[model samples]
Target: MINTLRANLANGIQTSSTRKFRSATRLLTFAAIAAFGLASTSSASAACNGGSTLKGRFGVLVSGGTKAGAGKYVDGTMTFDGACGVNGFVSVGENGTVNNFISVTGSYNTNADNTISLSLALPNGTETYDIGFSPIFGEAIGVETDGTAYATIDLKPQTAKVVSSAPVTTYNNATLKGTWAAACTAGSPGQVDLNYITIDGSTSNYGTFGNVTGVDHIYQAQFGIQPIAGQYAVLSDGTFGGSLTVAGAYPFGFTGSISSNGNELQYNVIYGTGVIEACIAKRVS
Candidate 1:
């Protein structure tokens, strides 16, 4: 009986040791997997190369106030050198009128934390912005940093990278042959205008000049929906312009650039009311 009891005690000790060994092995395996996941996340976040990541042409939109006045809006295309220099043309609206396309020059720097700083020399003065990049979306988003003005800016790649297909190098009238939904904002400090428009650009009645008809719904005015008629023309380089009459009376002009994928358009309106208006349209059909 004594021998049997001793044997039983020895077996119990061996079993407990085996169980502890298995538990330790599982803990090590879990720790290794967690470390691998953390390493992957760190590597992905490290891919941002700062301002040098911005290259080629980017469609730009700027809307807000300047040090002198309110309601300044700008939209155009900017070409970045992937180093420090940038130049572009923009249509600026201010003081009850919209200026013709004007040239703008700017310089940018990369911060230690991977953020970007930009200084744009405009016709009025130098405007500064704190810019941030999103690798997943491939865009640069920023806001005005100067105390006097309140504005926000965004830039989208004019040329899409080649992945499964060749990138769209140029665009013409037929490239915009579809329906589009547009979200737009226009305003000064006290007065703001917001509109949602559904544009039908699929009609081919006017040859290269596409007949566009849409409904403009002004949310602020509470004017449910008004029918608008317009015509648009796309340039070889994807710059588009058109005039639309709202409710058959009020007329406004607009211009913008199409994305390299031909899936989106970024545009601004010429309201000539001392307010800047910016709109982005995406294809729906």
Candidate 2:
């Protein structure tokens, strides 16, 4: 986090301040697994151009890849040949249907469903595989075992709107135009007041400034020139920062967040000395 930013307004009295934030991109991906002798297509919500990929039949197809248990050709199907896996086995076809294997097999779509009906095919029935029944085990006796392997395939229509990990509700152009009392502070051990009135915004906002002369009359009971004034941006995380000006001189400003309720607006005022560092407020409504 940048913490805060400030720039002198050429003049001596006023200054501009900005709150800090971190802007970074985040993406997430995970894998799904299913044991032998099963169909492709997950039972979860995944978006794909219909079912276009095939799953298992663990083994060496008469003609697929040099890799073990890999599929071959575009036979509108592929099978799993149980090879080196936890519960290895095989599923054959574009629909990923197969029989024969071992333990552990479940599912998740290599591609799920679509809001529309979509498929990939040539103009003619120029694509289709013939059925074959050629099984080989040994000279006579037979022994078999199934295996397992996990795979993570990309869902079709890879574009997705990241759902916020948290819920965020919105409010209309509602106005907070009432007079109320509040108690506030500026630093670590700041003081609280007996009463103070709210000016603008609402229970959760930087609101508007204008208490007599815009100075936050935080203590309600104290009487003097206000220390800060200006527009503030309240963040969803309940923090705030912005600029403020005094009289007609160079605009002095602060950056901070709100606490307790709308009644308080604490900030870091950077002026001559290092800074006021922190401040606090409360609603006297």
> Model-by-model lDDT, in order?
0.63, 0.25
Looking at model 1, which ten-residue stretch has the lowest summed lDDT? 37-46
At residue 280, what lDDT does model 1 achieve? 77
Q: How much does each candidate deviate from the true structure in C-alpha RMSD?
A: 27.6, 25.9
Each prediction's number of clashing residue pairs: 0, 58
Clashing residue pairs in candidate 1 are none
Q: How good is model 2 by TM-score?
A: 0.27
After superposition, candidate 1 runs with Cα above 4 Å error: 1-51, 65-69, 162-166, 188-208
How well is each residue in 226-253 modelled by candidate 2, as lDDT tens digits? 5433443333333333344433334433
Candidate 2 ranges with C-alpha deviation above 4 Å: 1-198, 202-213, 216-223, 226-228, 259-265
Work out how many backbone clashes candidate 2 has: 58
Candidate No. with top TM-score: 1
Query: For each candidate, what TM-score against the reference?
Result: 0.73, 0.27
